[model samples]
Target: MPQIILGPSQTKKIDGSVKKAGYAFLEKLAADDAVPGLHIEPINGSADPRVRTGRVNDFYRAVLFKVQGQGDEAHYVYLGILPHDDAIAFAKTARLKVNPVNGIAELVKASEPVAAQPAAEAAPEGGHGAGGAAPQPPVHETEPAAEAWSLLETRGVDKEALLDLGIDAALADRAMEATSDDSLIAAVEAAPQWQALALIDLAGGKPVEDVRADLGIDRVELSGDEETDEELLAALQHDAAKLQFAFIEDDEELRKAIEDDDFAAWRVFLHPEQRRYATGGYNGAFRLSGGAGTGKTVVLLHRARLLAKRDPGARILLTTFNKVLADSLRTDLRRLDSSVPIASRLGEPGIYIAGVDSAVHSVIQMAGSEVGAAITEVLGSRSPSIGGRTPASNWLDAAATVPDLPEELRSTTFFQAEYSMVVLPERITTRDEYLRVRRPGRGVALDRRKRQLVWQVVEAYRARASVEGSIDYGELAAVAAAYLEKAGCGVVDHVLVDEGQDLEPAKWQFLRALVPEGPDDLFIAEDSHQRIYGQRVVLGRYGIRIVGRARRLTLNYRTTAENLRYAMAVLAGGEYLDMEGEEEDSALYRSARSGPEPELVPTDSLGDGLSEVAGRVQRWLDDGVAPETIGLLVRDARRAQELVQGLEEHDVPVRVVDAHRDVRPGRPLVMTMHRAKGMEFSRVVLFDVSHDTVPAAYAVDKLTEGDRADALLRERSLLYVAASRARDELVVVWRGQPSELLP
Candidate 1:
């Protein structure tokens, strides 16, 4: 019988003589057939031979061999193992039992009889069965056989001695099992290969490859190039099924709601990407632009609510060109989230709500005395020739100086006479007396002459200031763009811009600067057709890309379909020809419910037209329409006043809503088309929709061909805006000739 090398430490200490002797013993045992029922065969040379040369410290000799018989095969057997002096010392230091000869002899003897057993009788036979069942054939008592093998074999080794060397009974049985049957060790060694196969199975499952692809991992091994469309579709369907709960289907209700211009439903059914645009990140900048009633403001409000909920510590700013619209948005936001603080730069808190001009003013305020001095110097530099004399007590005094003044300057006297003069229009006027009475210490007292001079200077300063800034509102965007260029975009996490399409090239530059390099940081909304101001803006030309994630809301809920149809017909050009009269029925836009059809009333003269429109306005008031809901929009302040007087003569509660005005407490808002850009009302009466009135004479004849077209486009956009302001009804009254936009 051969001795066994039990553990790695004892095997290392064996000397070469001991190892050779062990191997010789194993070979002789195989040749002699020492045990019955065992036909020993020496399959190979010693698997491991530990040889000690010279005086190498802590070294021993041992040999590993394979012993085979007719019944079973022993994968590993050891003989002549010896422990070194260091090995004995290491065991003693660790408080362990150390017996070199007995441990090795016991291991070898234990292995000998096990290798002598018949292959079939050593253990129970089991094969594949249906389901998880085990196939039964024959059974052998493995435990008793293992114990019998251990007891029968001896190489001057003791049982208690082997057990004391940390050789457990179970481990000894496993060793015997491995030595007896090569198949068990082969199965244990094949585990890693089985795990690899399991992974392949998982990867071959439906849609797993797609997920891997999305994650940028190779899925080629999982699915070879069979390219079966059925498999591909099944994979995608399986993936879609996983996200079924997250997706909001385009159902009949959603489709109908969108067609009916119900924003509430649209909000509910918004895609997750759309919701991300509305509320996701807040560290970057954003811009939302779109045609009228396309839910730009709706998205803005949603974004505000989302921001409020996400970052309660950070303040939110909401601004617009139209004061009324700004106020409306502020009101709506407040209604939606009461806990969120709301204020306007143009309104009270001087931070949240602001007009573009007002925001500029705040920046100027930060300029200290320099801005005030510049304003004073500019005001003083205005020519004394401009402005009005006190209301002449006599016609002789008026006639005396009136003739001496240039026609341009004389034509602007009414405007100059006002304390707060408007420089853009020659005829618009304001009262200095009223301003002085209302605001006592706002700034330097302005007589009619000084007011006129200051107005001129301020206009010039604004123009120069805009240019110097390289971007004012239009240039503010440019500055943003420049920053983006320099900073490389990672600085901002989110972006927001109100009136997105109104931004010109420079503004778009600013917008481009705001977009983060990553996909998660950018959100923008714009209405291409609603570029009412005709500003030289280009969103796409400046690298502001709109991918498939962009959404469009086409239905108009703010105005009746009849009006929307007419407006779309005029503005949409070829795209809307077939869509002219096609609109979902709604009570807000129906003529029967809201009012009469949007009228294209024309008269021979402006006075008659004004009177006729006034009569209709009075009739509307008489019919229970609130004065505030009825808006009278004209091309110019001169025409607006004429209509204002006409309505007043009919005892209508008329109030002119202008930026210059102190936002009158409550009156029928009488505004110019430009002033009414962002405002809305239940009923809007667009007064003087004549070709000449809309495309002011200067804009029509003075502009170059391209400029004229741009102006016309702008006028058309303004018309769209005005018509869309009517939530329920719309009326356009023209004198002499209809504008090209009128149906």
Candidate 2:
């Protein structure tokens, strides 16, 4: 027989006559000490050795082997041994145990019983001749097989555990098969107290009293229904009882009261300073700051309504970042108070709701006809002259020819017509002479040169209009701020500004000009997280004190935890820590329930990508997601055109919501993120969320131009706007490359 060592403590023996080549390999390994721990066991009798002829080839066989020290559980390793010579070399190189020949002997040796006692104890008591009375013939006493079977039977219990406690498996199986809950109870009746507790826990701890009643489980109590294992696990993991809100039973009434034209409800709800704005105190400027889901818009509307109620003749202004939201606010306000004459326009005497451009245009319009005409002319001249198209620069050149204009008038074409210019007199110049010639006087006279100079200066102002028109939203805010500061319009009794975080430093300066020098004159409400557009601007730079009165509405009733998790996953970049007690309820279902999980589809071509997204929209429509509830948000208008064409080809009704369109009831909206702020939908699909798109390549350099803090603030705010738009579901789909913002 050939012997082989398996491990440090095990060995196997095989008949040497099994094969000549196998015996030769074993002899070679034993000589080389490759088969360590090899030991031979003596055989009592010898017989003719039988030659093993057949060999089985199972080369891929790998075994998970375990080795244990005294009293310790085994540790496992996946050991692969091949029969080939190369495998023998590889095993040696890898320092693993190997037996090329008689490998079966090694395996058998490893499996053989370990020695339990010395050979001296192997003989029976009487065989050794020293044991007294030959153990009295071993006193044979046997219970009947039937009696033994009866002793093994159990009434009821955790059959497996009971069997582990020495009950027979057959008895335990029979006990488990018995009918009725009582059978289970009887089986567990003899179980240890700890075993009973384990069984109860496995059965969901039913018939057990809740221990946290004093802390109150009213908000998150389990319904009197059976729960699955997953649900129970979820309950155990979440502190559901901590997240509860005082139910507002009369939401309709509250919304109605907010919309009331009478301003009665607002008086009761608003603080004293807010009441001023709620009651037609629109002359002053203020800012509103608060977390998302709070009633910032509600206060804005109430202020508008109060203005309308206090003085029907006064013009109230309401502006936001997006036109759709402005229109929606208009609709909602109109629905609430039909008596208020609300006009969505600039320079309107009633209530005006618009975007930033509309508001600035209103101020420009008030500058009079000459200023307006010059602005038009300058814009036309400065515009590109491609194909001999009207060049906006021509208008600018014509206006620049004007001279001796006031500095303020020189900056804006709109300043040309209504107001005359007066140079501030120096020590050498007489103030009276300057006032006589340029100050607002009923019968002031001027020479032809001075009058012509004034006209030319007015034209110069028109030239500046083109420059102003080229400025972006942030620049416009800066320009507005400068204008307000130079004009010295003292603050009024009350000033209320909406979407405060979206305002830039310049815009804040302009707002400050509207606030009178008094305590509590300014009221600001904003969510820092919702500053989607104009993130380069900081609310604090606007110079408003954040008092302790700042309120945060943290509850999100609109989105489920799953939907929010997906949204945050796409936007958070591992930086956002979900606050305690902020988990969204997963049970809240959307009206349109069917849709594909938001996908990260890949396509080789842009056209294919567009087609894919368009197909998804069509499928959603077919699944009964109302066309109006579906939105295709792209990064820019150029990309939107392809999606629009695709939708049209599929005969799906779609509307591009830009500055021009009035948001209606049934049309689906397609727009850029810049256009979607302050508006929400039942479903939102943010497309082109790729790195090159979202923080669009152009916005990347903006951080270098603005304060780093302000830029980051604005970027986060923009993402907030995109996130809040989803009332039910938010799907962010991207293709080609993953967004840099993704984890």
Candidate 3:
């Protein structure tokens, strides 16, 4: 059967009405032993021996070429798709040949008037279309192109390697012309992010391993089948099953590939650094942490798929922070697994995917525990008395009323910390452990008698909650953890946690108890800078260790460098720590591409800011960006609702997505920064960010004096998460004084 190659640009153009037709065309081509359609014709001047254009229909045409294969054999490669005239013109000058070094094809112009040989690497859109202009080569306007750099002489790169590894014609020529490797490196850096990633090694004399290590390129491809097409990018790539434009093996594969993107499979192919996360073998606990857009979720999805595929019977628990993100994970996992059952229940035989709360609840139900009423019903009711009859006061106030309480422990604040940070997390049901515990961060120490009185108050509070049939999420997690510990940790073979930095001590304990301690036990993807929840957990304390099994992805694939720079500045001066209390460095984190700087709209008043933001939202809609791909994020629910109301009043289509079920098309998504975690958008508007609103005074006032710095970091991290959500553009609007966080 004839091999069919699909161009990246061709795949990109296949959407909506043309989507079905495009797939059908591929199906037809793949099924036929010979290239289908009598419309196939050759252009007069094409240099690629196999350059041919065939009619997909009356309007669309497909361009393909040939490259040397096994034993001087040849195989046809799809170049790209274009309209009739454009296709003919593209066929007129387009020349494609395989690159020896990368083993991918490059688009070399056949008609360019140049003193030097043309660039062998594919230019934008798989070598500029007829109407497009190819990139110009470096000038020595008068001199004939300097002899191309010799791979054998410059860097000991084999000139005749079995798998193609030839340097670019233009890049080599430029490299040969340069007096130093530094100049070559500078020139290659000017290429697009993806292109630069592939060509950075062309600068001979620069330690290749050092460059790869610097850029975190850990993988060495044995076969080069990745697309050379410039227009198509593997999204959330790590799972090779969804490479839409890579290559067509058969009709069945083509169908699956097209459908993968039609539904927006939660991210596609993982980057080199991200691939280790999915397939790497570690001795014990492994943690993958990176800034937003670094493909952490992609790694999770692929890693889950790999584990399931490697051992179908192994129980895998893929979990995250909330139900909404869990739902999102489920959706993406389905796209990756396809055949395996991904259920939410913990005891099921297949892979279990859910939020921490859902997983703990399932564990509770399995163990026959009183999971109790919803947290809202419990927190909202008065039956669970803290101290007085009415439930107006917090748990701390309820503990304060025990008579003869030690002077050091009488305050509500102390009781709250003693219970949550120490007693409950430590499962200190007895008074002795509470008295002896280190209480590391807690400044005040308590004697044995004081601990006895505090334990009495805590017991009374728990008894009241148990009587009311109301248990908080923390309580449920604690119960589940204790049960799993006694039962011996065999519920799941592997536990993969996403957004793990936000998990509290109880939740971490629950996870530790759920998975047995083994080689592939627990995998966590967390970014401390993105921790909005006020849960400061040191993972080692919970028995999950990641000291040497940690990798941080720095090259961001989603947002532009400009937006990322501004986002990073928010967490710049703050000392961010990992889940294990180790200093996590983000100074190396950077974006792969550049775009216009973030737009900041400062208005004189609230109404003015709202109106300005609404107008900008309208512009994004009019610019062809999908409404569903745009999001408006704020610091709280009130601000989000207000913005949604204001935008709707201005005739902008907006939807409030406070839950997984709330996502819908034809409207811009609106939510608080807290709700927007684990989500990304093409365009984002972070409005209502004023001095008082960003680091909301309410949140600040709640933190203790020692935690004031942590509170500030949390607030800044919120802004970072919000800003990084914008894939293409970010617009910030505020009234009076704008957020000082903006760089």
Candidate 4:
């Protein structure tokens, strides 16, 4: 049987009519690439004999490279679709070969010089033949000349080494010619996966041997001296090569890659580094940290599938900080492979997906009559509550009743942190326990008298909750953890956590207690820079140690380079710490795509800002961007509501996302910054981010210097999350002076 290889650059966007035609084209190739209707003809005067043009229809043509494998079977690599003349022109100047340095298969244009065209800034199309934009030229070809300095040359990476990394010969010259980091990255972005990564590391001063180890080069046969059919096939099988080329094994997989908009290429393709973490064996708990869009969640989902498939009866719990994100994980897991077993409940024989709180609540429900005993075991006098969560107003009421409480300790912000960081996780029940427990990450220091007053506030808060028959999620998780610890820690064989940075220590304890200490026991994916909820936490304190088992992913697979820069700029000079308290930086983070610089439109008034946003959104809609894929994010619910009314007044369709985070169809989405977490859009407008609006006066107004700093950091993170949600275009509109968070 013949195989059909799909390239990452299959540029035609997928829509209903195009999808039908794309399926017809793929089905013909699957049956036989030689099918007469495809009109697979060799390009005249092409440098490589394998280069051919195939007809998808009269309006579209596929550039292909025909390679014959073992026996009489032939495999055709589908490069991309183009118009008739363009396809022929591209085929004549393209060649497919095994990347000699990295041993991965790659397609490169021939050495024959052609006029360089300006690259258009746009989002990548999801599938085949729907989007109307033509493929843009490689960045290096279109980028203007730079100065005399070279990023790789300064680091002693010569052209020979560049070639050894499998960069195309022409791109290798461009890489060496690059004067600045931006130009170098633009050049590397045009290289194949392993090659680009090698360039990034080499330029970052990583030794060549270390780069080789990072690529797992020992496993692949590398030789630039020869090219063969067997080598091409083996190169195609290499994990890094799979990022740009997928060899479909079945019709269902084919449909997913070519038909479904929700089906991302990353689901089928894995970078070598990501593949290592996803399938590699770890002796204990492992944590994967990366900047936004760096494929951490991708690794988590793949790892869950691997564990479930490795052992049919494996009980795996895949969870996150909230219900919405956890629900997204479940959906992505199914989209990754629907056949992966999904358990109906905890401790079952398949992967169980839920929010950490939901998972804890399930433990309580499972415990039933025994849950009261578990709660008593963890919180001493506190029994399980039936009134659900104690509301925010209850905290203010509790703080007011406590006499002589310091003004700094009187706010709901301080009390919530005090409870989550020291009280609940430390299992503090009495005043003495609260007074004695250490608050490691808290910014404010408390002496004996201050501790005594803080304890009074804690006691009053608990009393109020007890009288109302309600408890916070922190206590709920603590109770669940105590129950699981007593139950002997095999509730699930493996626990996978996403958005691990946003989780409080109590939730971490619950997760640690859910899985036993052993190989592949716990897998966590987090980005501290994206942490917008809760306070800083140290995982080691919660028994989830990842001292040597942690790795960072730096390449962003989502947002464009221009947008990523703007988003990262939002965090400039702000201190961000990982789950273990070490300061974190995204210095090495880079994006795979490039687009227009994020627009910052400053207006004299709110009405003007709204008009500017509505006009841009209308233009995007006119350009064919889907309405549901356009997000109008703000810092508060009031601002979000204001955006809905403002956009509607301009005669643009819009809808406000409710508390459920339900994104309705056929309309632009208006959501608060916090609600935008774990969501992405084709285009995003951050509406009305004025200086007074962003740190959200209520969040930091009445807090201490230390508490104010923490609140400010969370506010910055909120804006960062909102900015990174944009996949292509990002616009920041301010009513007056811009937020200090903006660059």
lDDT of 3 by residue, 39-102 (tens): 6667777755557876777887767664434423334456545777888887777755333233
> Candidate 4 — which residues are off by over 4 angstroms?
28-63, 81-89, 111-148, 154-156, 188-190, 204-207, 218-226, 261-264, 383-385
At residue 248, candidate 1 shows an lDDT of: 17
Reference-based lDDT, each prediction: 0.41, 0.41, 0.64, 0.79
Order of candidate numbers by TM-score, starting with the best: 4, 3, 1, 2
Q: For model 4, how does the per-residue alpha-carbon lDDT over 120-164 read when each residue is reduced to its tens digit?
A: 211122211101112224445344455367778898888666445
Give the residue spans of candidate 2 off by over 4 A: 1-295, 306-316, 322-325, 341-493, 535-543, 569-608, 665-667, 701-720
lDDT of candidate 1 over 1-743, digit per residue (tens): 32221121233333345444444433443344345323232222221122111112224423333322232422222222344444333322221111111111111221111111122222222211000111112223355554544221222223222222222322223222332122122222211111111121122231323323222221121133222323322322222111111111223222221222222323433322234456555333344433566556767767766655565543445555445556666665654445565543322321265444444444344444344333323232222221122232222233234333323222222221222212211111123423233322121234556444444533443334333332123323222334345546332333444555553344344435534544434455555555655343334445665443444433343555456656665564321100011222121111111123566677888778768877787787778776777778888888888888887776766888776663454567888877776667777888888877766774445343434565566666667767777776777888787887765
Question: For every model shown, what is its TM-score relative to the native structure?
Answer: 0.45, 0.45, 0.79, 0.91
Prediction 2 global C-alpha lDDT: 0.41
Runs in model 3 lying further than 4 Å from the true structure: 1-7, 10-15, 33-43, 66-76, 92-98, 101-195, 198-253, 256-268, 369-393, 399-420, 441-457
TM-score of 1: 0.45
lDDT leaderboard ranking = 4, 3, 1, 2
lDDT: worst 10-residue window of model 4: 114-123
Which portions of model 1 miss their true places by more than 4 Å?
Answer: 1-290, 313-328, 342-493, 511-522, 572-596, 662-666
